[model samples]
Target: MMDCQRCGQRNVLEIDHVLPDGTEVKFFFCHTCEEKWWDRDGVQIDLTEVLDIVRRHRE
Candidate 1:
């Protein structure tokens, strides 16, 4: 099973991109973490933008 790279949680429900242009590199994250960090963290950059950024990065 995969776990979150940040919190090390095993409830990962989505994949996260570490780079722009929809790269393949990513990490797993749970719904809670996605709302807290992914939505607010400066890492995401665009707030309104939503891409296959989640599914495309899945391992």
Candidate 2:
């Protein structure tokens, strides 16, 4: 189970977000603090990083 980064709550929600450039990314949302981030290779990445990757996508 994933815990919220801000509130350290174990009640996390999974969401599918499409970036401005049309890249599909899966991230987790912390219901406690409303913290959102992507879990990649055991690391939490902010939404801005995901947007950057999406902007670089072709086709």
* Candidate 2 lDDT score relative to the true structure: 0.74
- What TM-score would candidate 2 get against the native? 0.66
Which residue pairs in candidate 1 have backbone atoms (N, alpha carbon, C) closer than 3 angstroms, thus clashing? none
Best by lDDT: 2
State every prediction's TM-score relative to the real structure. Answer: 0.30, 0.66
lDDT of the candidates, in the order given: 0.47, 0.74
- For model 1, the run of ten residues with the poorest summed lDDT: 35-44
**Which parts of model 1 have CA positions greater than 4 angstroms off?**
14-27, 35-59
Itemize residue pairs with steric clashes in candidate 2. none
What TM-score does model 1 achieve against the real structure? Answer: 0.30
lDDT for each residue of candidate 2 in 1-59, tens digit (9 for 90 to 100)? 77687898898998766766665667898888887788555666776787667667743
For 1-59, candidate 1 gives per-residue lDDT tens digits of 55555677767665455545444343335654653324324244343343455445553
Model 2 spans > 4 angstroms off: 15-25
